[model samples]
Target: MTNYDFVIELFIRVDDAMKNMPKHSQAKLYPSELVTLGLLYAIKGVGERAFFRWADRDLRPLFPGLPERTRFFRLLATHQDWTERFLAEPTVLGIIDSYGIELLHPVREREKTLVREREKTLVREREKTLAPRIATKGKSNYRWIMGAKYGFLLNQLGLIVDWASSWIGTRPRKAITIPSSNP
Candidate 1:
């Protein structure tokens, strides 16, 4: 059917995209295996681990030979930049956003000096500068998130024209402009 061909074309496109990516050393999974894994991911739209099993069963015949899970992870970590480039591609003909990837929570390390300065500022403010925080529910009925609403401006091609991220506080934080270095 048409859908089947679409999937096949998408897989081929994924493989083609991998050609431009950086390669790795050491004997492990082939770049083709990594491409198949990525295609399976795009089609299934599931978690990373799920795609591995899917690749083992459904994709094995397509690849005919794939390294074990260890090799798969190794290949994945080694070629992470390719994954980012693959996801960032304007395949949809417009901007797209995805948060499906469950990455490991990074270790939180506090900067002692920065924390001390913030503490000093808090002390200086005292009760005179204390502002009562009011909780407001969003129109969507989603749980109240104590954060500022942020949006990134992307052109029609989906490349980030600019990005602005700010933390929630008494007053709106100033938007910092990110210049496009390419131009």
Candidate 2:
């Protein structure tokens, strides 16, 4: 009900889940403590400075061994991988969708199309190296998009199971399989 109660409960859950994670004796905060703080920061949806101030003022009682502001944040960042323990496993059913984002107009793409139409070989190796290759021509319902597209796979409970992104018209391997709960 209260923030303190919620934080304590969250810490308990995180600690129970992370029982296998080895903790360093020299570490100021336990792995669970750091994870609890990180989870709080994510759930609060506030800037680091504000979260630090709030924790220092309100949460100090809960986490008496709280480190200084910088070290506290650095610890969370360093051990971020620990949070993966909370990721929901892929279920038997899921939803998949994609969204296309436009970064630049298809000027270069159109130019290349026109050149190829004339049966002319392109010799713009230098231009190719200088272009932004991260985004490619992808299509959307509105029109052709000259950018990138991202796809999300969500389980029945709406938790993200997997995701992929690629150029338009190109498909990524669906390697994320939903195994039955038995195995």
lDDT of 1 by residue, 1-183 (tens): 554465567667776766755545754455655765655666678876777786677656556557787767677677654554543322223342311111111121134335657788674565355434322222112333343444454546667543343333223244534334353
Segments in model 2 whose C-alpha atoms lie over 4 Å from true places: 98-151, 163-183
TM per candidate: 0.44, 0.61
Off by over 4 Å in 1: 2-7, 20-28, 87-153, 157-183
Question: How many clashes (backbone N, Cα, C below 3 Å) per candidate?
Answer: 0, 1
What pairs collide in candidate 1? none
- Global Cα lDDT for candidate 2: 0.80
Q: Relative to the unseen true structure, what is the C-alpha lDDT of residue 156 in candidate 2, on a scale of 0 to 100?
A: 91
RMSD of 2: 8.2
Which candidate ranks first by lDDT, i.e. highest? 2
